[model samples]
Target: MIAKWIKFQILDTERQDWTRGYDTARRYFDREGSLDVPYEHIENAYPLGRWLSDQRRAFRAGTMSSTRADELEELGMVWDTADTAFAENLAAARAYYAQAGTLAAPRHATALDKPVGQWLTNLRRPNGLGKDPERTARRAEQLAAIDPDWNPGQLGWTVDWQRHYTGLTALLEAGGTLDGITPGVTYRGDDIGRWLARQARDWTRPNPEQQRRLGKVGVKPAARPQKTAARTNTKARAAKGSDAFTRGVTALAQYIQREKKTVVGRHHVEELPDGTSVRLGVFLSNQKSRRDRLTEQQLAALAELGYHWTQ
Candidate 1:
């Protein structure tokens, strides 16, 4: 309910060194509204500054005092540090914050922090707000403002689309470059984001990766992979409604029926009469997987599948 954070709006400029302190405070809060800056950065001359910094991080990390927390409640945050869920999230936030590199935070602050939006999401999810799509949309907009050319998977930590953006934020704060991360994890934000905007977004393809998460409960991935669709369409278009596709389809179908043997992954890439190439059951190419647009597997797996594509 407090917009512009009532405290930041009114600073005590009469104090010496107030300008630099306020600027630093304002900048820190402006991005994520969390405190927990290293104690060294605190302008000890102003106790108010230090308190403000601590309070924000405490709130973001779910370590707030009861009285201060009540204020957040009044703002309709559904906040609660006592909940195990909140504790788990706070723990994760602290870990991420501690690893954060060179990013500004209150000097001597020990607790790692979560971005304010992330903090709110953790707070809200336990309250049944359903992870707030609008919040993610806003975050994407913010990320776009940060880097228009951002490609997902620059960090190569996970396949989750949300992680792509979250990792981007962390990398920026750490002052790390894309080159520092594992390779081949990018998608046009425009495409990948919409893919994430849908429900069941955190997904792993079972046939591709044999992920157990989808079947663990009654959940499926948020979206069918865009890569899957593109790969399929490319094959179809390359087929061009020609008899070759019919023949290939018929042959592949017969191979399955006759072999009654399972090939772990796609066995081959067929260059149809058309310019487009058709991967037996996927878009993967032994020579082309792990290139951001597509995912590949171990060399042993590729070798087992046997290559069939011709130039």
Candidate 2:
């Protein structure tokens, strides 16, 4: 199955070169974002082709190494050498290259393209490229001297010490097990503690659903009624309206009486055995709106209140 997942491919070097040339030619066709001159014409007119041909000839003739050495000498480097200084420099260069390769390509390329002497100079400075054995030893000594009673794993100690000594907050933030410290765990500092406290506050605070549940559980206080126009006044106004308005009001009333039955509306009235009828208006008013359905608890409460069906 894994073998089926993998596929092999090969690059056509000649085709690649041809495609590159084609792209370069296309760039000249639309000179909005690039150079305006036609590269193909320039290649044909200038000694570019001849130069490339000569380079290929030299490569095939095994004269490329000698040519490269002469070019290096022109840059002020003594290529022909077997001395200790030469050997040491070569070793340092190789080590530097290895270290640079571990970095991102852009940074690596920048370091690699720097002058050899300049790069070597950078490696010797206090905050330089080369590793300092003496500094490493001194750090170890300082760590040992850092109040033997001060546990490195303690919350404030590591952060405070690292800040005072190295100012490497990034390294401290990217937590890991240091010497005498537990792995996959971080010390809780003031910031972390505050974060945890805020999270606790958020968790303890009631959400909408939780508030509704708490209301149901009789733990929360009853919600205050919204200030609304009296239903009696509304009904009185509807009754005194024009013919069209009266018809609309009648139709709405009929819709509420008929269609409201399909849903568990509070309009469902009940009569008691003592010949007393309870107005569903009270239950309806207690709800969000008369259109809202009654819960089982509300229904049971209505029943306990001596309510019976009354059409």
- Leading candidate by TM-score: 1
| Per-residue lDDT of model 2, residues 1-311, tens digit only | 55543432223554455345444434433453432221113443443322333333554567656664354233333222222222333333444345432111111233334444343333322333224577444433432342221122221112122212221222243552122222323332223223222223343333444334334422333244574777778867645643333232233344445554323345655444446444444433543343223322232223222221210
Over the full model, what C-alpha lDDT does candidate 1 score relative to the true structure? 0.38
Q: After superposition, how far is residue 7 of candidate 1 from its true place, in Å?
A: 27
Estimate, for each residue in 30-127, the C-alpha lDDT of model 1 and write its tens digit. Answer: 56455433323434355433444444566778665677566434433333323323333344343434443211212222343435333532222222
**What local lDDT score does residue 88 receive in model 1, on the 0 to 100 scale?**
39
Error of 2 at 234 (Å): 94
Off by over 4 Å in 2: 1-64, 78-168, 171-311
TM-score of 2: 0.14
Assess each prediction's global lDDT (C-alpha) against the native: 0.38, 0.33
Q: List, in order, the clash count of every candidate structure.
A: 19, 2
Once fitted onto the true fold, the runs of candidate 1 whose alpha carbons sit more than 4 angstroms away are 1-63, 74-132, 151-264, 268-283, 287-311
